[model samples]
Structures are given as structure tokens and as C-alpha cells.
Target: MHQGDPRDGAVTGLQAGDAVDLGRGTALLGCGGGGQVDHMVHALRVALGADTVPVVPLDGPAHSVIAVGLVGSTTVLEEKTPSGRELPDALAAVERWTGRRADAVVAAQIGGVTGPAAALTAHAAGLPLVDADLVGRATPRIDQLSLFVDPLPTVTAAAVTSSGLRIVVDAPDPRDLETVWREAVSHSGGWAAFAIGPVDAELLAGRAVDGSVTRAVRTGRAAGRARDVEHLAAVSGGRLVARGRVLDVQRGGDAVSFVHGSMAIRDAGTGAVVRVEAGSEWVHCLVDGEPVASTPSCIVVVDARSLRPVSTDRARVGDELAVVVLPGAPWWWAEPHRTDRVAPRAFGIDADPVPEPGQRPARGGVR
Candidate 1:
């Protein structure tokens, strides 16, 4: 498996316990994308005072296990952060509409700000935070969830805005509900809270990404050693990629897009040049015109100074970033299954996996 962050450096000092505490807080702040560490960190300072935080797993009773996500324009949410109380109200409204008591609250998406947001929502709702999530990485569409895998029946849902506007949509197909809620949220210039998928408690186990809090802690520790503001990424299994400065940005918008853009990377020390294209996730990575990483993998971008992950919605030009590629769960990379599902090619690019001259293909036929 590929290490999560691969940069040139001596490994820094990191402890497992620290990772556990920071990770627990990070998960809660994941707004709608995975928990954004920035928000999680802030929330932690305000909400958590005691030392020695316990990382909570997403495994809990499956009966009435509801999946919740913030749906709306991320841009709007950024300008107007949650009030901390709105999320629980939304959850309660959904419960009232459905008459179902939630056993656990699971994140629907676990990237960007959403990761931490979900965790915070769980904490606020006083529910157990499940380690599992619908999408391990950020996805553009709401219907792209494993909870819909078995063709489940109609579950209840409530889409609430912070401004006290609430809309409840219930149907067999959660996708339809997602579409409706997205449009509503977009129009209102607000975000919606979603709770759906009446999942069987046992199925939620072993399905979500576990140990991410610990992983983040470890990654942060490794990155804390760097003295300058450079590109630093958290690899899945603790590998380093390239560390550099953002020379140019080809795209930027405010529609809550899964990140999509390309940039030129200049090595901080040697001043070497590397051109790379990034999408909703760091789906493809090239060093000096060589492909080193791609999708079905975890690519995290963090502020060189804060050592925290950045959300696609907030990534900006000249933001010094570390591009790290970590191995995703083995299930996604199995055989030829995920070949085009989440890669750059799947999103309509003709470039093949460009391995860094001497490096072999991590999987499949890159040779």
C-alpha cells in the first residue's frame, strides 16, 4: 500500500495518543465533506477542554442507524458557519418526521469540512459517532453512497437550514431526495442537514473508515517538523509525496465543487519543476512530468503552517500545500473494479497514469 504522505524529509516525532485526541475533534468538524480539520480544531478548543480525548468509532446498533450530511452550497456555509445548535435541531426534526430513534449518526461524506462537521453533529446530538461513512473521500453527488447498496426502502429525511427553514422529503429513493434538497439549499443560499438510510446496525460495522483520527494525528506529528511553509500531505500509510509551493492555479470557483484544477509545483530547496492536475481529490499526481499517484487513493492537502487538511471549496492559489497520496482501503483498489470509477480519466481526461520515471505502476497496466 502507498504511504499516506510522501515528501522528502526525516520522519518527525509523533505519538499515537495525540493522534487519537486530535482525530476525535477533527471528525466532528467535517461539515459535509470529511471533517475539515480547521473547523474541528476550532470546535475542539471551544468545546473540549479536558486532555486525553477518546476517538469514537462509527460501529453501533444498526437498527434505525441514520446517515446524516450537510447539503447546500459549501460557499454559503463557509461565510456563515454553523451555530452549533442548528445541526441538532435538524436531526430532531428528521426524527420527529420519521418517528425513528437514531442509534448512531454516521457521516455521509468524510472529506473537506464535512468530516469534522459530521463528528460535531454527532457530538451535539449526543449520539455515538460511527467510524463508518458513506464515501471515504469527497464525491460530487449525494447518491453515491453505499447505504443504497441493497436497494433499501424509503427512509425518512429532513433538510433544515440554519435560518429555521426546514423541508422534509421522504421517498424510497434517497437520490431523488438529495436532488430536491440540493436545489432547495442552493436556492436559499444555505446548507441543509440530511438524515436518511435506515441502515441495519450490523452492516454499518467494518464498513466505515476507522483509525482516521489516529492517522491524522500521526500525519500532523510527522509534518510538525517542517520549519517552512511548504506543501505537506498526509499519506494513508505514512508515506511522503512531494512538498512544494503553488506556482499557479488554473481554476477556482465557489460552487462547492469537488476540487478540480492543475498547478505547477516548484521544489522548495532544489527549485525543480513539477506540473500536476488535481480533481475533487488528488486523483493524479506527477513529479517532474511523471505520474506518482492517482484516485481510489486518499490525497490530502494541508496548510504547511497549520499541518491541517484543506477543503476543496477553500483551496486557493498561492496556498502552499503538501500533496500526499495515501493508500485507500484495499476494497476500492481491488482488481480492475475502480479503474475508471474515480480516476481523472473517469472525469474525462485522456492522460494515462504517468509513473515517476523509475517507479512502477502501483496497480493495473501503467507499464
Candidate 2:
């Protein structure tokens, strides 16, 4: 197997403890969305048991790479447990559809569950998990992948349901594929494992977000030791914008398949209010009606006492919380086309995303 260049600071392979880090980091990266990692973490821990999952550098060998993940409501994932075979079966279906073997695996979204799930699948398949992913953070739509941002050719996609039903799609338009696959997920009892792509290392390196796996681990480790909001901010590159107790929560009426809602948090000290909007993921955050952070970038809420991340559904009245805004992947903010896809307006908010303090200027200046 090929390894990363030490000079380039690439992670050579995953370590046993990295799973804990990945779980924590991915939860933070999920930006208050992507199913929580608790179940997935337990699953991976048992499956990997003192074994490290191999990681391939972005510049490693030129073999086919596949992106794998689960799609549906986090609420549903809580009730249905994976049999541990869904992803590998999806990979097999992809290979049969493509008529080639995948040399390594990558994650479609690096979030609470998807990151560990991808690693476990790669380990089970006897392939390395690339230290990169399609989405640096989680997003609501399947079409949100970085591969689509570059508009890479998606040769084929395969999905497997818990009941063992499998479906494969070959489409010219990625958006069409997303629509079709989402319906399949809805029919497959709300969640399914999916595999997409046959791209080689060079293409994967160019299109995928690099170093995200390592970054997640670092963030997780920092979060574990963080003592307060300031310490958490310093470690995660986030800004502690508000400290408050929940005032009210209003869920949107969209029949879309993801979490969609808004919560009002009142500053415990000043009584000033900040409202956070959600759409499968945290999309927009407002402080007294002014935009502070928006999607693509991460807006997270942590329990004031525990300093643990709070998912939208789990938030409630009188719950003390601290809202933090972390910068999105630089790629999302680097271009006009990319920013537009995940902008606050894209989620129906009437404002632009507030860029992080030192973010690279977008083509149109923070659209």
C-alpha cells in the first residue's frame, strides 16, 4: 500500500484512538446535523477492536476510489441498527456495476456516523480509507458533494437497504441521481448505505477535501480537553457568539426528509436573543436579527455545563447552551459557484452567509 509523504503532513494511517477523535470531530463538523456518532462509534469500536484502519494519502496509488455513506433521517437511524454488512454489500454492488474493484474508500460526508462507517467499511473490504472526503462537513442534500462542485462524472451509484434490497443507478446528471436515490432511501425504511464513484487517486485528490480526517481527529482531541467556551473556540477555530438558555423552537413544515427547524436562544447574561435555523443541518444563525453564521460553514451549539455538542432535535426550553460558529471548508467559500450551492439563501434564508474572520474572499465577496 502507498503511504503519505511525511514532509507534506499527510496521515499515513488511522490509529486505534483515532476513532474516538473522528467521532468527536465529525460531530463538530456535522454543524449540528448528520446523525449523532454515539451508535456508530460503538459499532466501529467493536468491529475494529484494537485494529487500525489503513489510510491512503490523497497522492497515493492510482486505483479506483469509492465514496460511501448512509442517507436519511437521524431520527430513524436511532431505531434501526445496521447489520454491519450494508456498506460492504453496497461496495460489492458498485464493483459489479462498474466491473472493477475499488482500491480504497472515501466518505461522502464526514459527520458523526458517516466517517466511522466509511472507515469500518474500508477495513472490512480490505482496502484503505483515504484521509479525505467529498464533503468536509455534512450537508442535507446528496448533491452537496465536492465532486459535484467540480462536476466530476459520477459513473455509477449503488445503495443497499437494511432488508438487503439493493439498487444501482447510472446517470449523466448528478442532481437527477440525488432525487432518485432520496426516494429510494424513503422507500427503504428511511435510511440506506450508498456507494458512488470510481474515480482514481489523482482525481479524488483534486476534487475531495484533503486532511479532513486528520483535522477531525485533532478537533475531537481538543474538544475532549477544552475547559470552557474560550478554550473550545481556540481549539476548534470557532467564535463563541452567545451563551443562553433555550426560549422556543419552531420546526419548519417542509416535508423534506431532513431536520428542519429554528430555535430561539436567549443570552443568559444580557437576555439578547439569537435564533438558529436548521435544514437537515444548521443553516443560519442570527444574533438579535443579524446574520452571524450560515451553512457550508458550521454553526454548533454546546451544552454550557458539559461543553458537549447539542443536536437540534435534542435542544429544549431552559437548556443552557453556547452557540459557536466555525469556518466552513475553505473550498466552499473560495468560489462563487460553491458558496451559492450552500448559501443561507439556498436554504431559504433571506441573508448571505457571514464569513469567518479570516476567510479567503469569495469571488463575489461573501455571498
Candidate with best lDDT: 2
For each candidate in turn, the TM-score is: 0.73, 0.94
What C-alpha lDDT do the candidate models reach, one value each? 0.55, 0.80
- Name model 2 segments beyond 4 Å from true: 1-10, 255-257, 365-367
Query: In model 1, how many backbone clashes occur?
Result: 52
Which candidate number has the best TM-score? 2
Model 1: per-residue lDDT, tens digit, 99-187?
A: 77776676676555555555566666666555556656565556555555445567567777757677777778856876788778767
What TM-score does model 1 achieve against the real structure?
0.73
Error of 1 at 133 (Å): 2.2
Candidate 2 lDDT, 244-326, residue by residue in tens: 88999877555442547898999877778999998777788888988878777788888888888888778888899899887
